[model samples]
Target: MSPTPSHSASRLLILITAGFGLALGAQAASHDDEHASGAHGAASSQEEPKVIAKDSLKQKMAAGKAAAKAEKSDPKAEPTSVSMAELRDLIDQKIAEVRAKQAAAPAVKVVNKSPKPRAVAMSGQVKQSMAAYGAAAVPGLPAGHDLHWEYTGTAGPQSWGQLKPEFKTCSSGTRQSPIDIRDGIKVQLEPIQFDYRPTPFRVIDNGHTVQVNLDPGNNITVSGRRYELVQFHFHRPSEERINGRQYDMVAHLVHKDAQGRLAVVAVLLDQGKEHPMVQLVWNSLPLEKEIEQASPVMLDMNLMLPEQRQYYTYMGSLTTPPCTEGVLWLVLKQPATLSPYQLSVFSRLYANNARPVQSASGRMIKEGQ
Candidate 1:
């Protein structure tokens, strides 16, 4: 309101000039701040080391994959093939060890076997041969006659045959007898000298025959050999073939020498008078049956001899079964007399115990000429 136009113009010019100078100062200060901040940031970035890509990421990844594949391809890295070969070798070694152990064990052995025995067979020719041998083996038995005993029933002829299988002939042979002694060639002979004496006597009812035992002193001399008498046995229906005749009863005198050789003398008995020897045996007869014991009495054996010494001699088998050969037979030509009572006593025990005559069967029957 107070100043003129020219003054106002000069004042405006001054204000404008002041304003322009203030603006210039402010812009300069802002520029300094910006430059300071930018320098600090650059210094911090330079303090820390910067990372630069020397190799490509793709190349690094490819190298790692290649190393893994190599590991997989190497045979030593895995146990698959080695483990299988080692296991097979171990198994084979174990098998070899087992075989060796078996081979080291002990060996075994075996035992032996044994053999069997044979049996005997008999025949008719065998029987005849046996009979002939028996007759020849016995020293005093008579020839041309077969002497034997009979067995039957409870008192049968089978027992005698069974005593020795050789005696089988007694049971089987035919021509056995209890005949009448009627036919005989007339021949002169020495009278039997009887030396009858009493000694200890024993009687045995042997299953086959009634055996009378005498002491060792009793004996008979024939063909210059003195044979000690041992026992006497009876055969019913005497088994002697006298001129082909058989008798009712026959007595056998069994004797043994020191050498154990046997001689049997046979005597025929007929019904007549009381014989001294028969009487003695009957008087001492034991009550017990099938008993083989002796009584305390002396027995006289000479009394059992026949009145005549003339005899028929032959080789023969025992008239019993299994008729063994090798017995010498002697049959006195003369017969001894027995009373009815004596005959009855013998008959009571064994009525008709007799063996039939066997075939002389090409055997030589000789008379004591």
Candidate 2:
């Protein structure tokens, strides 16, 4: 007998489901066999490890080490891929670049210790000290406290002795300047020789006094020796140690010999008519506030000479502080005349410019006589 259509379909579905179950069962059985084999191998290895003695195990380890060393020693074992030459070139290039960079860098420099700060501080202190004293207290000058232009009162020659310690001659020294020319002693007169020429002139207000610069061509010859005129200036009450006395006004003629010896000739000026030289200096005077340009005008050195060649000679020092010693002093016996106007001009500029007279100290005051 034949089955029905529905029963046939149902039978087909059951067959399909049974085949799928069978396939899954087969795969499980295969996996279990693989796991069992792995477990058996592990257990067998552990059971067999007791076969080796301790010494034998050590020997086996040594043999293994030796085998590793032999493999390392084998020349052809490792592939020769890395090139030593390439590595060395790369290292050398890096070293050269480092050296180049170092050379291009700036060199290290040291600084100098500057002295300007110390010098400025010291100068300030000196100025402060001078201000406190009122008058400038230079070493080796008269000690009078008052400041003057040239002569009289505080600026007079009499006060020089009390101004400073170094100017002791102001009181004690006997050979002083600006002495009155009383009577001329009879002496054989020699013609005064004058050698003057046109030369450049320079004038300066020197802060302390008016200094006239003379060129080298101007000179004076006395007793066959040549005395080069260096410079000439004015002093208030003259500072000449003649027979030990002081005068009203004086002109100092500074001369230097070839050997560098100094000789100063002082010409005393009395209150009288205006002298030609005085007028010349006053006419060319620059405006009070400004320094005028110096002109190359003819100056007659002879005009300042004494009418009577008679003179008093002595050895002395500069009356001014820093009183340089060893000066040959020659005070003319004759006096020059200066008008009140000329004297007033100088007084306007400097009322007390003269240094106080110094002591002669028994120095030999020789007369041409």
Best by lDDT: 2
Candidate 1 lands at a TM-score of 0.50
**Superposing every Cα of model 2 onto the true structure, what RMSD results?**
33.7
Point out where model 2 deviates above 4 Å. 1-192, 198-200, 241-246, 288-292
Task: Give candidates' CA RMSD values in order.
Answer: 47.7, 33.7
For residues 44-154, what per-residue lDDT tens digits would candidate 2 score against the true structure?
Answer: 444323323333444543543454455457766432111222222433454466466556545422123356677768665533323221212232232223333234577
- Lowest-sum lDDT 10-residue window in model 2: 79-88
Candidate 2's C-alpha lDDT? 0.56
In model 1, what lDDT does residue 72 have?
54
lDDT of 1 by residue, 41-80 (tens): 6554432221112122224334434544554577675443
The Cα local distance difference test for each model comes to 0.55, 0.56
